[model samples]
Target chain A: MSPTSSLQPLERVRVAVDCMGGDHGPSVTLPACRAFLASHPNAEVLLVGTEESLRPAAGWSRCTLVPASEVIEMDDAVEVALRRKRDSSMRVAIAQLKADDEGHAAADVSVSAGNTGALMAVARYVLKTFAGIDRPAIAALLPNARGGFTKVLDLGANVDCTAEHLLQFAVMGSALVSALDGKDEPSVGLLNIGEEAIKGSETIKRAGELLRAAAAAGQLNFHGNVEGNDIFKGTTDLVVCDGFVGNVALKTSEGLAGMLTQMIKQEFSRTPMSKLAALVALPVLNRFKARVDHRRYSGGALLGLRGLVFKAHGSSDAFAFERALERAYDAARNRLLDRVHDRIRDTPAVLPTAPDEPAAAHAA
Target chain B: MSPTSSLQPLERVRVAVDCMGGDHGPSVTLPACRAFLASHPNAEVLLVGTEESLRPAAGWSRCTLVPASEVIEMDDAVEVALRRKRDSSMRVAIAQLKADDEGHAAADVSVSAGNTGALMAVARYVLKTFAGIDRPAIAALLPNARGGFTKVLDLGANVDCTAEHLLQFAVMGSALVSALDGKDEPSVGLLNIGEEAIKGSETIKRAGELLRAAAAAGQLNFHGNVEGNDIFKGTTDLVVCDGFVGNVALKTSEGLAGMLTQMIKQEFSRTPMSKLAALVALPVLNRFKARVDHRRYSGGALLGLRGLVFKAHGSSDAFAFERALERAYDAARNRLLDRVHDRIRDTPAVLPTAPDEPAAAHAA
Candidate 1:
């Protein structure tokens, strides 16, 4: 759990930004990038998009315009992102993380607010997966009732995950939390219907066994099983599940929050008395909203990849996108990629393929 | 769909109550039953519990005390409820729905606030599944943004579901909604990660195909694939999914709601000024709270069983338990059983084994 690099002025953390992704494209990304640069003195940004599209950030300090010919729409299929849009801003942004002939990478990390499927496909194809990892997973922080964020992974990345995959996710998630949150050891909970070992599908039961074995071997801080409610209760530092379930939980939370917010607004505007009350309660309500705002937790790091890649919400505003940028910068500064490798290297018994698998072949 | 029985002076809807079930047991059940009886003059209640516990409701009008020797605790295992506690109140309540030698059921419906696993196991064993239904599903109403309840099924009934099981859930969910909500044809949506047909697991894709086939054959009002958020958005009248996913989604929604409620309270009570604002906003806040209260939406109907069985939350108060009883009563009065049978009988093409499978064999 040592820092990979000292916070020296000479060591600049470069983040490649996909300027033409998300709903607002440059409008959100540019402003967020500007704010991000203003805060970090020793940080650089590789603006990856069409030359004309990135014209606004052309003369910005410590910013490099990495030209990309095409744009990947939020609705584009995986095939379109992987094959047809080879020069997509997302692909070029990810490509900046690839090492050069002299073994120096153009960017330390990449961030995109693009379609999840497209980003995953493009990133996996360009930079490739890390050694011992069969598939890369989407990892994000969910705000919990404990007033802290619980890291959840495999969120819509690999829908049909195996028991071994769950164990891998646990290892990857632990590293991400340790590197970013600075928690040396984080407890991981296997998400299931019931806390009992016998509950859930065959895959889940098998996953529990693997996680327990990993825990016994001192590889993961496995915390038995947890229900969906446990995610918000902050019962564990990390909650691991298959992509489908994770995706559903994330979207369900969003949906419920949206409904409640609307309901509150509707209730306050129902009568003149209520309107007066709302006016009085305005400051308190705004403070409450800020505390639970999803924008503060906008980044979803793509774990198990050779290079660091992050995803922001497709509908992110400047504030939200800036949070994503800050998250990516923190992950890069904390040496997330090396931390993942260290965890995988140390836990070879849990991940048997690490030693034998060649880097290039594993990436492919 | 035609009514199985017209409202008449002789036609009294009887509901069997598992008085010994739930956290408060008789404390909650008795008051709920009393309120239910007062509301529906023609409705009779079969209070199934030990005679000692039922002594308080002894001479109540239209209330019959059906004595049971044992009680199933909230945390009792399914095996304990099925094998050991044969005469448990939960079992006895479900038994009241079984047809007697004279071909008449003792009760029209049953309600319990016991553990879900034990209740489902006992209900399935005693009442048996309906013909063509391989596994029973738990259907419940969730408050949606459109000011209506979205009927979601398989809320932790059968963990491992096949494509056929999902189709069965859709049919049963459709029946439940049509009967309870009085919708002639309720549109059913298959819960998935995305709205696209090819976005989920293999089983989901197959379920989507089967649903489309059923729709083409004019059996179900299939609304195609829906994301988890769609459930709250009121995209469809019914959202069908496997028990595992449904359970996770249900618990996740509960978790988010609880967190938001707590946050709102904390925010309003932070300071003297905030508390004063809260005093002013008390009426509006209470109104908003009532609208989104989960208690109003209590009761998960165990569908696909031969008899009607509704499950209240184990932690239900008198008001919440009453909601469950009312739901059961409405379901019974609306002829939910007959509706399910009619739907199953009509969609034989979608259910291949319905014509050939015997009731007893399917039950086993």
Candidate 2:
């Protein structure tokens, strides 16, 4: 409970959670909710789903029940998002956010670990689209050698993407880095097969032209085309790709983490002396572990949505769920939804501007 | 050398070398050719390219010059393989392998470190296609957790591959496994995003279906669908994919190796004590370095061609070039090409009954 006392207090941030999502269900969600509430005593939480299913999950005093009679299966089609998962906790959560006649539309945020496809589908359908945004994008943060990773999107939300979609993703991602990483202008790199200005799939090449023009216009800090090999090199603050390759690259990196960790364990076990050395170096090892913990980062915000919606790992463990709660709290406190709104809406079609230009050119 | 003394003095295999191919050209290739000829004293070499270019290079002895007039530039289009570079090093090298009048064609191989697309085009044209093959495929070996690693194919030869093309790759890869790793019947894992029997892009899904039929008919050992995250988990001996994803995976792995090695060096430099530990482990470090050196396995054989076509790395240093030469010499001396031919030609449509009878039937 001292977290409230341990830090500066701010206005309460309401976070609606899909209590019925994830593999462990109420077993993990209930405890995390209690932990989060204990830490941030002023926060409000709406636990969505059937009362029968969420009753046990409502042990925390910080939680309020948002009852519904639907549950969407993981295997359900994306169309179900339009139909409202009849029994899905995710739908009920969104419904509760939508009904905030008390000025909730612009104040609250939603978080889900349910079917990612469904979350995007329903969020776009119910929350409506952000002005000037054509689709919602899933952007992930990776540990970068040069500090923070560049965001790569349409992670897996849309398979068939146009060059315009790539351009939009770059803009949204740049806005994020500026707000979150405190970079007034973050460099953007288009993912391609070559680092040359003249490379990649025909689509990527065309996207390059648009991005370069935008960068020249000062809309983005376009760093030119970067190869898949350059993603972890931290060559840029954002990476643009179609959903298919982006998803594959994301999964491949995740898989490599598991593979490399397993290899390290085996390598350490190869000799008793090395095991002793490893034991002595546990603190340094802990530093490395903390440096790469995905759970600490938790959910990836589904950007370009009118309402704030974050996606936790479908297979996230307890700690991951706790971090998810904090992320929702942070996003709400940050007024991320409104920020996304003004950034997209207020930007001129010309995007960037030359140095010494009037700040009011945004009105043009 | 002693191993050669024990042989029955069988006729040595002859191989044509593309002296002008690769980034280092004469600087790297000339020494590599001499070292290769020295290792296998009885082997005959036909060094293809202009005599003037080869003359000033270091260590040019033990090679029989087969003159080529034109040198194909690295960025040349595949069209050059048909016209302008007809007498280029890459084309002339393959021509030597196809001409029976050249004395070497009866039992010889060809090697290049040229433009991958051009090499494929020229090899296809000069060597022609094998009896049951429609196209030649590029194959590379990746390190796996288990010793001997998996042999991956269609690295980037065909962008849009058919089910039959993938199936044939499985067949050819199987024979290569037998020739290179001595695995009589290697299990083929169809690369996809998930490990379940069902999952992947439309192309992989269809290839999985065809593999199921082929495996059931005892043509190859099919190990079902494999996830990208589990690629190095040793689920199978060979992973088959179309050119696109495979190229991405290959390059991603290479780039990762660079990033990780750099990170480790930085980590070890954190303090004086860690640096001291690093110094003491120099010998062991060398062993570890050798274990993961990509150059040790730089050359990959282009399977299903009428004549041998070994592809070396263009960025290969002197050591890497030597390793490629070694691989080329081993392929020729060990009768690898002849073995591929016999296996593809004679391996029964009904492969010999194996231990895992249920696998093929259960995979698709």
Report the number of the highest-DockQ candidate. Answer: 1
Candidate 2 residues A78-132, lDDT tens each?
7875674555788767655553433434227777778787888887777666556
What TM-score does each of the candidates earn?
0.96, 0.79
Each model's TM-score for chain A is: 0.94, 0.84
Q: lDDT values of the candidates? A: 0.87, 0.68
Local error of candidate 1 at residue B78 (angstroms): 1.7
RMSD of each: 3.0, 8.4
Instruction: Evaluate every candidate with DockQ and list the scores.
Output: 0.83, 0.25
TM-score between candidate 1 and the true structure: 0.96
lDDT tens per residue, model 1, B1-364: 3232232213578999999999999999999899989999979999999999999998999999999999999888789999999999999999888876555778888999999889989989998887788988999899999999999988888887999999999888887887778887799999999888988999899999999999998888899999888889889999999899999999989998998899999999999999999999999999999999899997689888888889999999999999999888888877777777667767777685545332221122
Candidate 2 docking band: acceptable
The superposed Cα distance between candidate 1 and the true structure at residue A44, in angstroms, equals: 0.9
lDDT of 2: 0.68
